[model samples]
Target: MDLSSVKEALAEKSFDKIADVCDNLMLQVASKGTAFHDDWPYAIHLLGYFYVDDCDSARFLWKTIPSSIKEKKPEVVAAWKIGQKLWTHDYAGVHGAIHGYDWSQEAKDLVAAFSDLYTKRMFQLLLSAYSTITIPELALFLGMTEDDATTYVVEKGWTVDATSQMVTVKKQAVKREQKVDSSKLQRLTEYVFHLEH
Candidate 1:
């Protein structure tokens, strides 16, 4: 397989093609029991998986690459560390790992992509934890403007108290009806009568 073609697809942001190439490359590497001495293919493959939000596959590929090869490529190693932070839902660690570091162009692009993904994931986590939060707090957590936060809350069908600057997540009502199965009850009654006799 031409690894250059895979890199080209990644540079072009043709993620689907990159995924296919990475899949084939992964299979080939597995069958041959040979490691990728070159980092480009592995790095691009990792980025492709990240683009599709397939962190599991990305981490799997990262682990499959030889440590000797990874050690030689600081950028790839750094990217992997950042990806690990993402997998563990440590957004602060992710940011801190890449902050002020000079990354390769590809790595920089990957980090940029991850920024949005992290924000979205953080928002989801916050939503689960808080029934009500101020718009400013929501905006800060989501890395969005207050206006955008308000819009997001509205879009999610949550109630907004404009006077209080708070968004309220209406709890979903769960129905818990206690109904016994008639046939099972009848069988139980018959079994009780049989035991009594």
Candidate 2:
């Protein structure tokens, strides 16, 4: 297995190619039983899964990795911690966890990728849950400044109420029939008839 090629792919952010390479390497390891004792393949696989937001598979890989290998490669464990936080919707924790450690270049790249993905997911969830939200609240949730958050909401086609400092998502318009009071109509007709006579 060309581990260096896998590393290169990861550094370049070629996630699909990394997945393919990891799958092939996993198969070879399954058939041949550990060609090399180093855990780079497993670490790379974990990172690939994290990049794709496959938290469950990444956790599975983490669980299966040998204790010695995990100790030797603490970066993998740190990456998994971020993935765990991400899976549980602890976006703040994810950010804090990533910054709490000095990770390898590959791990840092993975963190950056996950941060982008997490921000998108958070924005989607916020939009779904609230038709109108204050700019400050949205900014805090997305870790953005209020101005940037307002801009983002406006860019997504949601209306921003500058006076109220709120972002509003217009719900789909519903057509409703105007109801007429029959008794009021009858009285009005009678009054009109009397006046005409």
Candidate 3:
């Protein structure tokens, strides 16, 4: 189980690499006609998927895990709870699962990284979806207290009304000039000409 590559990726907090390496390792191990023994780092692998926002892969991995391994490892089960919350789009539940578990030293960093990325992703979603939302709702989505959420959004340049406690999302309008690929256009033209003839 040459996990040097996995260890290197974990050291750098490169979750994409971790997910890829762990997945490849799983395949390699499976090709050997054996199951993932106790040596396998299931918690790290699951958290790696969550960190990369690959919930589908995480879910599949969980399903394919050996029942014996699942029963033996509480850490793996805890990590899957986070994935389950993520699959259900339960924002608060995601945070709850994360904080609820006592992760091993090997997996602690990845779990914290996943929580941070999840919060930031949710904040981005909130930006696109709401013009004005209450601080309590923002806290729920961001997994923070109302005060922390208010401070966070304010730091992100959102305006909060003192009386209403409604934080006005700062929407940045992106203006992209659509460019047509000339080669694609020429190919389309050629195909149309042939069809017409």
Among these predictions, the greatest lDDT belongs to: 3
Cα TM-score of candidate 3: 0.85
Residues 59-159, model 2: lDDT tens digits: 77778788888788777677777777777877667767667778676656755776676678778788678888888878766767788878877787889
lDDT agreement of model 1 with the native: 0.72
lDDT of 3 at 93: 94
Q: TM-score of every model? A: 0.58, 0.68, 0.85
Rank ordering of all candidates by lDDT, starting from the highest = 3, 2, 1
Candidate that scores best on TM-score? 3
User: 1-197, model 1: which lDDT tens digit per residue?
Assistant: 34666667657766656657778876776689875457445665666676677888888888777877687877677667767876986655665665635777765665566566667777677767999988887776666679987897688788899999999975556789999999999999999999999
lDDT of 3 by residue, 17-60 (tens): 78899988888978997766787888889888888889999988
Model 3: weakest 10-residue lDDT segment is 33-42
Q: For candidate 2, what is the TM-score?
A: 0.68
Q: Which candidate, 1 or 3, would have the higher lDDT against the true structure?
A: 3
**TM-score of candidate 1 relative to the true fold:** 0.58
By lDDT, the better pick of 1 and 2 is: 2
